[model samples]
Target: MRGGAELSRHTTTVIAGGGVSGLSLAAHLAVADHRHPVVVVDDGSHPLDDRTWASWSDRPGLLDAAASRWFERIRVHVNGRTTVIPLGRYRYRVVRGSDLRSVVRRYTDPLPHFTFHRGHVDRADQDGVVVDGDHVRARWVFDSVIGPEVPPPSEAQLGFRGWYVRSERAAFDAETPTFFDFRTSQDHGASFVYVLPFDAHHALVEHTSFTASGALEIPRVQQEALTEYLTEVVCTGGHEVEREEHAVLPLHAAQAQRRRGNVLTIGTRGGLLKASTGFGYQRIQRDSEAIAKSLRRNGHPFDLPEPSGRFRMFDAVLLDVVTRESAQLERAFGALFRYRTAEPALRFLDEATTPPQEWKLFAGMPAPVYLAAAGRRLSS
Candidate 1:
């Protein structure tokens, strides 16, 4: 029973890591069956406390009801210049993790077949997963707990800080969320400021860095950088900070393999994350949906399927190119925007929709540089 309250003693599907991916998978499994026993284990260090999950989507799903804000235009800035890209039919939506948890709990709490345990997963093995010496057996185990080590084959790190602030005066447009304000200097790797304006006077401002390696004073640096940007670029002076949000995500272009016997990887650990953008929320949802569909169709546990081969190859080449030459990112991004429609580009990044001609155009941009980087990575 996936959702029934009756304890089955032992479960068939045991998921380790109760974050977005794990919880979502559990919910999907529950919806699929009322008899498949599913248990989710969390170490208590849930990242859901202070993070915002935002992604571009044409259709709505789990987080649709919790969407606090949305925008159709994303502003990009580079070296004091700004470009506003209209999303056309696409909308960039945001939903806080706390809200997501609340929604999942509402549905999952009633089900007897679903159980959530608060504990640490020490290690995962071929048979099952070990949680604080308690061995839990399952036909399939989906793991989402990945640590700092196990670097992606070829990837870069991006350190960033997000702050939710209430301004003293109304300074932001309530209709549009400033996706990337690239007006800041690109000297320290590639730096940018993003604003997710909740209303006219409140927004989540973040200072982001696309660099290889560095220790950052997140709070101090974010405040300072934000203060400077607000006063200079945004011209929103004398604003008061009310609340803050911060995080560091590795923008790695790593090739992740699936399968450890019956144990399978999910979420970022499963290479469901976008290598270039560090966007995993939508990808996680999509991956979980696919897995659920597979389970329903197969009527048994199975090994996880790999992501699109073409997408992986493209990401690998792009990552190699970016790693070898950081300066080309801005140009590459600019070309992508200039050549392709915003909708298609967003779809491509989300791995939802892509056209063959668009891919051709993508490969054509910076042909010499891309080819060289691809060749270098392949040879290496």
Candidate 2:
């Protein structure tokens, strides 16, 4: 809604795109002792509560109150074998989008320093953001809207379709979540099915694929694949799909860095999602905390720390293998879950391992495949 009579406004900070990243930043800023005037702008374009975010963490934080479920163990299926890996200190947690959004709103809505604007942003820079033909001026801009575009060369897409289903019989391992099951057809790419059971008869069965260069499939195609997966490997017939959810994540894409002047980026726009695996909740949390700390200490949000360099290199190597040579992935991942050395591998993925621990875990990996991938990465 724009009017011709000098449509101009101002705030201490302008946050564009009210998705997970934008809302999370606002929540943190609203809680600080010395609060700044913040305005959150959104287009109301995409449905917010359409996906579930899952991550593995050793300890709960501020976001744990919204958790839908958690598991202490994971079962990985590969090459007609099931390997049960225990999460000794870590717990695999699932949080629904609707619950997360509600949590953020509850904390930020009552704060007098925060305001939410419903408008699509037209442009954003170090100066401010433009929404619906009106320029919103700000001293600093924390933008989570403009992100790196997916490149054409082997642009990997992590596509998933999940269904919350109920079975007529008791037919699920409720205590454990199936992290990955490679029994499905891999014609599209390295495909698998993941099951997160709510109880003996209710579960969220998801069919996922990792491929290079392709848009997400239509709803019918995704449904057929999920149904086929359920009948064959997961459970028997006589199960009804209660609800469906789908999402697509780009892998090995470029990252956004803090820009010059008074602009900073956060969340997916700032490369919070891990390239090898589509996990970003914890990263976004850590980033938001850092931003809040920066704002509290220096009265600005641009002086935040970057992710570890070693972890970035490791991720790049794994992404190269996944995009260039995917046939060896099932074996590669299966080796990581072996009973003898699963703990260090999990720690490595969490980016919490020491150099010695990382090397020990790397020793257990498919050395030849990763070595080749590493060489290619270095040369490139």
Candidate 3:
């Protein structure tokens, strides 16, 4: 019985790069209908393991069945002291990528219109995507593959490593996520320690930066930084590493253009990445929803508007301000949070998600250097 179904031929809407964006789009497509065929190709046979994705939101309506480790409070450390910000209305949530993949896969697999192909994509073009020397044609393609050396807005390359670990002796309040622990010296281009505790005994610790250029031993460096922070700063010892996740996201303003002519690019490859923070999950989710709505209305895939010039200009200004005055990050962030609601700040960081009052407040923050940088960007 299984053999007969497996041998059946089905037309598919091909999606390349089965990461969060790809999988989410597939799930949306699956939920939308069973008439149109949807196919996803990924290099990994198994779902991504040992990785945690953190996002700040009041509700968990973005992705269904996502693992939501909620924290009503956050701590920001600077100048050798920690300031706890009680976010009664906001909750910081994290979802493991593996969990997201598994849930999406389970939901999409049952649909006869949905299919997943495990292979490496050698090239993608207007015709279709070529996977491992095999050509598969589709009416339309959605691509998320991003290559290195893409033109970046800035010259700096920021990178970091994160790990999930469990400790027995350490005292951990799982109710709160340490948003920023800036106890480390900012001399090395703004370094900080961040943690998200799922339970009293387990947490994901990460060492991140605002400026990390050129080639780096990402795993080794992240491991060392995490261990050092855990042992020396947090005073937590006897911790066993459960898993490790590492990534090098360009903090600089990098422009990733749409390639595959018939293929409409979604997610990071479509330049949905936030120019300042490198956070793409929420933006990509929103982008996917918009694309899905368009497809549903038009009855076919189409190119997205390439992200508005106004949004890009705003992002470029913010990126210029941050990179030029890396030292003022703490003060700038403090002012933003202290003066405005978390919701407005989150929206502003994601681009123009703020009212006029919130925008004025954000603009009023103290950063003469950043203001100068912004002016330069505006002039340019």
Candidate 4:
């Protein structure tokens, strides 16, 4: 990929890194019929992998259309207790990554205003983005490139490996999803098992851990734990693993909103990820819509609302507690669900809780531990 030939053309908006965020922005912009010409740049290095994104929402949009499974109840297991939390009006849904990409492409591929380019963006400045040594001047550049990740003061990474397995007989309750199972070992950070059952015979069993980001052995340990879970708890009669998935989640990391001239960051790079839980599918949707609205209404993409500081503070406090007080983690989470209920806790994590609601939710936390963590964060 060279610079000179491709530099001849320019676009009004250049969306760098055509992953979920970029694809989402382009899809929304095309759907709204934005007047500006948009170009999506990529290095064509995205691996063909199977992955699933799960989130909670009331109304379905592009994500719902591509979803393969939905659940009305989530179960949380901790301290030898099981809690089945109903999803009242909202639905817990899972969408395949392949399907999401296909759905987005279907909307943008035929649109004349959108163009997909195959190359790497060298640099983005206030003026434009440099691709293959050539410059493509644009009014605004939306960059989703995450250079290097470093966990915040909390220093916790949520690592997990999941297997899509099929059992020989009925072994799962398809209507309910295991949101968290803390029955696994918690020695290497806060460890848990998560399961999403598609049917009586098939399910995705995952082992997740919250530990230091530098812990290289976390993945292997989590995999071992997942196997133990299958043998002891899930299915003893035997099961065959069909597909495997793994991820290292940056839990509650601080993100700085940066702009290099006209380059505005989006996606994980722009602090779109929910710091505490490592969930960003819904955030991506909301952010893409905001960007599209800005472009359509204000003729610029940067005219957007600021993220909530209070929610960010809350995330920081939780991350602090998770990393600093791993032993008390189970008790802390148990109290949260026990006091706040699943829906309110989910809403709080989703950053939708108001002042009064926040107080009510906070009532369930272990008072001294969280208060100390909050004090440390505030003093810092």
Candidate 5:
């Protein structure tokens, strides 16, 4: 009923933006230490069904219950030819946003200190956050809403259009998902389609693009590509689009920003999205776990380690090629999965590879492109 100055409402932690990162952080605190008073403020944006997170994990971790599908191996396509990549330790997994929220509630809803508020975070500072008209002071404010203003001018926008569909006939392999199928048109950029099948009759078919010029693909244009892919390649029988999703994310190797003295960012705002791959679900979970551990171990979440410089360099170089050399993407991307074991490439992409592993992987790549990219990127 009053502003934060009037009532002086307070919590140990205030989370701004309850997307993947914020909720993941909340889940960590709720599960590990229930005594921490945490409030999550989320503006109701995308519906739960329209949201899904797909990533890979080599070992067990939190949100396992939230996962609806797991793939032991995945397929990749280059010019209509397919290669099934074997993931020795890693398993590709999908978590529906609704399921993740429900599972998190199983832990957080019972905790007296945990509060889920539906509101917009208007401002955040060293003292606390302003949501709507209320001010909630907190010792730590985790933000996912605001960050570097798409700066570095951003190299590209990774666009996605996904259709959650049900086919009249068997149309997919339930156990394996197509990680990347390049049979789709690449006119827009380095585009591909991936099919994550829940069963033989239902799947989430998505078209993804790396628009090198940072231009967004119109819905009608992307929709036509999806229609062609579905009609000619994916489906044998008519399918119903039960739901749909569209999104555009920036691609840039931007540094994390500290907005306020006590406020730290999470998710994209925190630079968790790898500029090269546009994948952050796994990184977000890891970051959330680290932040939670830091709070318990050091009484502050800022005790987290900085990201590796080598990984930043790798992302820069990869981002350059993905955007600057979009036409040659097949050779650059397909090489990782073709005629080689995928474990090393997977580890490299995850930034978990050792120097030796990196060298071995690099030895097979076109050195000139990478070297030139490194020179330009490292110099800049």
Candidate 6:
């Protein structure tokens, strides 16, 4: 404590970042408990922008009605062939940042026990969060300010650059989305292009890479990739880009700090982002809900389910393969999708598959690389 610094406020919970993860936990807590107030603190440096979160679900989700697009099948390009995987009971949905912000606000804004505290947090811990030399005391703190906690020198990073585009004529099939088109150069890393078509003339096409180098090309390279794809692949004569979005996410084995006293990390910082594929929307949702249920039922949010050890091994090995064999990323994925069905793969990636199911899925994979990677990880 500074000589003159004092406790500025006291709340039941202090969320250190007002991004999706922090606000999500706040909303969950506020709804589950009425006596305890939840406060979300933020620096507001990041304004809501063109980012989108995409996930698939067998049942309806909180933001499904507001989703920007939906697809029931995924088309994959691998080994000079195309494979279409049908999602039997699941549907893929893309939710925009603005929509997610509004949805969560509708849940927190009207509650008297909920508050949105604005300012940059200098420090956050179990005792409270310090902002502008004033400390806000709280019983618990959910921190999402990642900083340097993720993508350590040992981890891989996923980089992306994409555009929301409108073609001059009918150039896309609105019903299906290209989950992965591994036609891009692999010199940088495991790179692929994906298209989320909203209609015959409009889509959000992007190029994403999983790399250990953590490097991405901007206007020159990104623009060229899209131009070539739209012209040759989409067979389009002309197109206009409505918006461009770029981002990077850590691809590392997530180690959630759930047992820590009153200071718990959430979201990407908490290891909710899957290390192998870089997906996290559904994982974050599951974690937030579990945390709230634990707090409501057990009087503590730390009562959460443990991640499977096998999945941890799987994620680690796949990440090793991605980094070691960047040039054959498509081949590894192709082995998994050889069944022409995506439901099992989705469940496996979601970490909900059983041992037998997992075995069947991996049996078709060309396993020499995976075995070597697994051996190295296990020995180390």
Please list the C-alpha lDDT of all candidates, in the order they appear.
0.71, 0.74, 0.67, 0.77, 0.80, 0.77
| Top model number, lDDT | 5
Worst 10 residues of 6 by lDDT: 1-10
List TM-scores for all candidates, in order. 0.87, 0.88, 0.85, 0.91, 0.92, 0.91
Summarize candidate 1's per-residue lDDT along 145-178 as a digit string, tens digits. 8433354564565667777777766888787777
Off by over 4 Å in 3: 1-9, 45-47, 59-62, 79-81, 146-155, 212-225, 252-255, 303-311, 339-341, 358-360
lDDT of 6 by residue, 1-380 (tens): 22213234447687878777886777677667645767777778876556677888887755455577778898888888887789878899988878877878887778877777667778766577777677777787888873333333336778888889999989988888898888766766788899988899988899888877455545466677778888888877899999988878766664655435677788877778887888888888788888888888988778888887788888888877887778657876776777757888788888888899988888756678888988988888
The better-scoring model by TM-score among 3 and 5 is 5
Per-residue lDDT over 52-82 for candidate 4, one digit per residue giving the tens place of the 0 to 100 score: 7788886767646778788888889988988
> lDDT-based ranking, best first?
5, 4, 6, 2, 1, 3
Give candidate 1's TM-score.
0.87
What are the per-residue Cα lDDT tens digits for candidate 5 across 1-380?
Answer: 23344324547688988889988999998877847678887878745655889999898988889998888888888755888877788888989989989988888988877878777788777788788867777888999886543345565678989998888889788888888888776676777888888899988899888876547577876788888888888864788889997889887675666445888878887888887778999999999998999888888888777888898888777768766766556766676666455676788888898988777667656889889988987787
Please give, for residues 110-222, the per-residue lDDT of candidate 2 as tens digits. Answer: 87667787787887765777778767777877777864333223336788888999987787898988988887766556777899988989889998777665655556656
Ten-residue region with minimum lDDT total, candidate 1: 1-10
How many clashes in candidate 6? 0
Report residue 144 deviation for candidate 5 (angstroms): 1.2
Between candidates 4 and 5, name the one with more favorable lDDT: 5
After superposition, which runs of candidate 5 have C-alpha atoms over 4 Å from their true positions?
A: 1-7, 148-153, 339-341
Task: Give candidate 4 misplaced runs (Cα > 4 Å).
Answer: 1-8, 146-155, 339-341
Q: What is the lDDT of candidate 6?
A: 0.77
In order of TM-score, best first, we have: 5, 4, 6, 2, 1, 3
